[model samples]
Target chain A: MNFWFAVFRQAGRNLRQTWTSQLMTFLTVSLSVLIFAFFYLIYTNMIGAGDRLSDDLRLIVYLEDDPGPEMQEQLRRKINNFDKTESIQFISKFKAYERFAEQLGEDSDVLTDMPKDFLPASIEVVPLKSLRGYNQIKLFSEYLATLPGSEKVQYGQEWVERFYYFTRLITIVVLLSGALLILTATFMVAYTIRLTIMGRHEELELLKLVGATNNYIRTPFLLEGIIQGFMGSILGLSALYVLFQWISLHFAGPGLLNLFNFTFFPPMVIVSILLGSIGLCTIGSFTSIQKFLKI
Target chain B: MPKLVHNQDPIEPKDIPGNTMIEMIKVSRTYAPDIKALSDISFTVDTGELFFLIGRSGAGKTTLLKLICNMDTPSNGLIEVAGYNIHNLKGKKLAHLRQKIGVAYQDFKLLSDRTVAENIAISMEVSYKKPRAIKQRVRDLLEQLQLTDKHDALTGDLSRGEQQRITLARSVANSPRLILVDEPTGNLDAATTERVMDLLTRCNKAGATIVIATHDSSIYKDGNHRVMELRSGKIHSLSRNNR
Candidate 1:
């Protein structure tokens, strides 16, 4: 028989012999990968959502007093000089009041008795795509607040900071779970390989006695570990893809998640994860086989 | 101290007549501190000699055989087999040495679940023999021992004599440079024993060095070969067959 063929055949036999436990080991690794990928997907989309929100970032410069025509032109030029603008609009005090009443709807009566000049006029600035990042917006807001007739500049600073930190936390979780997946995959592979060695103790000894090389004897077991890692990663990624598709389809319309625009891992990333997991399993298998077959 | 026939001029395996296939100098094996199995005994076998180790139950026959194959380490001494010093052998070197040596166990150490053909083919498979060649060799070995009908039978399902023949067949399947047999006829009938001996004799004549460790005198009684009789973990006498 071809040496490789026999080695794989032996591996198949071992897997079959301990199939119940082997299946459990496989599932364990898959679920670990699933958990890791779940967190990773969420982390990626959160960051994507954060970036998307930044793309639509608008900073409003509220004024203490309305500027004169010449002063308004001067303020516009100052804003332009600060950074490029997609569109700069001057919302007058009346326009601001109208918008507030429209937003309140039935609650408009609560603001009906308020003075017409109650709301302050503001200059709404929507920065260019490249200048919409948090730090850029923060710096631009600080600069805008100092503008001639500007009272304060705001882009819901508190909310953006909170969301940024939230994504940072998810990044941490993703990294932690990634390390966890590595440990789980390698440990499960090692445990399974060790069990197979124990079960075939007598058979292995006979093979050794019959002049089988350590390489020959352990090739099948190592192949078993590698196959387990490969299958587990594939299963986990497929499940994650299914989840991504279901979420994408069910929440297709505009919603909070729609802002996320979920994207599954690229093919390259998937291949890397698969190869990485296989590498971990190979280490596990090699170490366990070495420990058992010291001769 | 048992008589030792050490190599005066050790030579390469390719060299002629006086080339010692096995050279042991004051070999001793002890278990757990002081339980001597084979003590201060030594001997040498020529390139193609069929040698016998005769001893009673505790006579250290099996221990001596184990030491020769590097299965058990001697508490002290050097064992050189086919030119490799087995005492310190390891890794690929040890594997290479074992690949050239075939051993039959007293317990008929066959994979009970594997078929007779597979059991014999293992020796060849470990050496990377082609499938067709392995199949043909298995068939030939089984046929030689009158076990052609039992080719597909699991070793566990075979009779004692059949298992014995299968073990012997497996040991010589690779055409090893050395063959070590322990209790070759322990489970064999008279006729089966005769057939097993014939096959071994044929292998010996074909130039593989042979070592048989047994307590059964009937197997080596009238054979023209060297015999080392052991008593209580040491050699009692080393003599050539008189008949």
Candidate 2:
């Protein structure tokens, strides 16, 4: 038989003989990976929400009362020339009054009582996508405040920036915790494998004595680790997907899905899962074999 | 009339003809700073020779065997097996060297999870033998050892003697040039010991050098084979029969 085929067959036999131990390993791997996936999902959703909030924000530069047409055109030109400005829309006083009237349909008298002089014309500046972040929008708005005949600059960027900062902090914390958890899980799994190998040290020694090379002796254990890691990742990912779908279906509130309309995992998640499983198994195998298969 | 021979404890050294297959020159094995297991010992095993190393416990017989297999290194000496200096071999070449040598442990190092066939197949598998060839070889070994009926039995489920035989079968399955047996008869009954020794004799006749380390000398009468008696970390004498 091929060398690897023998390794695999031996690994299969080992797994069959120690099904309980293998099952325990599988559960440990699956739970750890599942926790990681859940945390990653949360982190991804928070980032997506922050991005959407920034995208929808616009900078409003309120106009001075009775500004002349030349000044208006000058301001419009100035707004257009700004590097951060993507598009500018001029809201005339009449259109503002009409919008007010529309909003107060049942209370039209309140809109009629407000004098025409009380309304202020404004220019809405939509910034480029790169300038849509909290700090970037704040800097842009502060610069716009110094413009001539500008009554005030109003944008929800400050609150959004605060939310972004808080959520970004949360994402960092969650990501760090996830990383630590993954390391812990890997170490634990490796130790378990090592102990299991120790229990069968005589068998391993026999194999070495019978002319089994390091690779041939280690292949089965490595495959076992990989199988456990794969099973864990799949279980974790399936659980996360189910949880995400269930939350999306039942809990339509201001949490992750509703606030961000968070996108589901693309093909990349599957690739990541494969890579993660293989990487963990490789590390576990390398470590276990380093000590067990020596001489 | 039947021949009458003296039952000496160890035969005289002049009777042994040297055709060395394994040689160790001034070998000293010291673990850590002060633990000296074997010190300045030299010996040789001839081709197709059946030799016994007799000593009490902690006499370094196991360590000697391990050194021959290159599993452990000696503190100082030149150790050669099958005409290669063992310390220089590494990686696949070391594996190749090990393939030429077979070792049996007193613990009966059979893979408990595997069947008798699989346990025996490991030897051929490492040598990269073809599947059909491995199957045929395993079948032939099973028949030779009278273990054909237990081919599918788990190694752990077999009796002590059967397990030891399986270990022996695995050791000789690759038809190694040299076999290092550590306490081969330590755990076997009298009948089983005789049977195992008979098998070893057969293997020696087939041209494989056999070196057995044990404390049991009741069954091994003097003048039957060469005997090396070790005492206090040194070879007290090396003798053989004048057959």
Candidate 3:
């Protein structure tokens, strides 16, 4: 206990002696961590939005023209019995024409000039939350096409699959980039601390001559590094939080929120930041001391 | 007791009783591959003995001290301090051996950032002395070295004489069994040198072995301590006076 007290006292003395150096270290660490946090937040928000979009995805099943009520009922039963089906809505040929007319607006004469039976009735099939993506939706559509009186089945599987794939690729890229940035920051901090230790080589030699063991001599400097890292982390976290709030307030539209949502920073993210800061500090201090304590 | 004469040869280990404090036999140290600092030197210091090593500046006085303190290893041969072979000691054992020996450098290597009391307290702290005991010991040493008034002053603020005295106090704070001083009075006035030597003699009386390296001949002229003069790299002569 007394040993640790002495170590802290010495660390305090070092901080006072090199306040400018400490401040510089703090700024460097803080800026790096802030950048990491920003990228992490973006990645997290993108994943969340992607998941929501995937969950709400719907499969549209177009149908053959003018099936009798009995055939339509049978089709509905088949879809309801399908394992992946959540719900299905039927649209008759007349309703499809009406929707086309609504889209044509005051130019409804353009649709009226077309053949009356050209439009096809369709069932809009919504899959269960668990059954998503192109493969499952394609299988369901194939089953629908084999049903009696059904000539065609169509859904937006191509675009939905492409969207999912693109988002997944983006998430992977973000994760890889974040990991690389973290590694680079760690190495940079370690090198900085090593340089600081080298600058004080003469003082260290004097301490060694006076009978200081490696631990006794190193504990204070290591503590200083840890304190610097922690302070930097706190500063970075606060700055990130303020920036996130400002962006959220200034850009409240769904298009912007869909890209950069601040609400995605869960409790786990805060824990991760804490652990990351400590790990960086530990690596920096340990590496620096390894070189400095060669004697 | 009768005083030994000048130029008398040191007693061989085979002829003497076993009460030696330090013994180096054929110790050779080569810093670089080509630069031999100490070449096959052999000597012993008995318990509570005051021994002086007089030599030129580059005659390896500091290297000898480092060897005895286990800070460096011999290139060849054996060195035993307080019956422990120093060549084989490492890590914790080396630290233990170092704690038993007090060392003072010519530059008065005091920690400039700490106060005089704190500087002296380091020795006691390393030895795991209790805080209260360390405080009292610091006080006692400051008074003994006539540095009581400068106890709380920063070491950098003190004069060279005062800083040297603080270094001495730090060296002796743990009551080490041996004191290795390299040019303890090199930068001091004649009066300060006498005072430092007197303090060292007092420590010798209290059963601490003293090994000093100096170019100052005046100290050996009036003292009864054994003096080993180094001409080139090897011992030129070993003598004792009856002052």
Q: Residue by residue across B103-212, what tens digits does model 2's lDDT show?
A: 87777778787799988888878777789988898888777777899999999899987888888888887788788888877778887787777777778888888898
Q: Which regions of candidate 1 fall more than 4 Å away from where they truly are?
A: A66-150, B1-12, B15-18
Residues A1-295, candidate 1, lDDT per residue (tens digit)? 5567678778988998899878988998898889998998898788778887887679999998877788888988998998998988888898899999999999899996898778999999999987776678888899998987788888999999898789889999999999999899889889988988898888888888877777788889889878988999899999999998998888888887767777888788789888888888888888899997885
Which tens-of-lDDT digit does each residue in A161-204 have in candidate 2?
67878877877777775675567557756876787687778777
CAPRI band for model 1: acceptable
- Which candidate leads the pack in TM-score? 1
| Top model number, lDDT | 1
TM-score of chain B, candidates 1 onward in order: 0.91, 0.86, 0.88
* TM per candidate: 0.85, 0.82, 0.79
- Candidate 2 vs candidate 3: the DockQ winner is 2
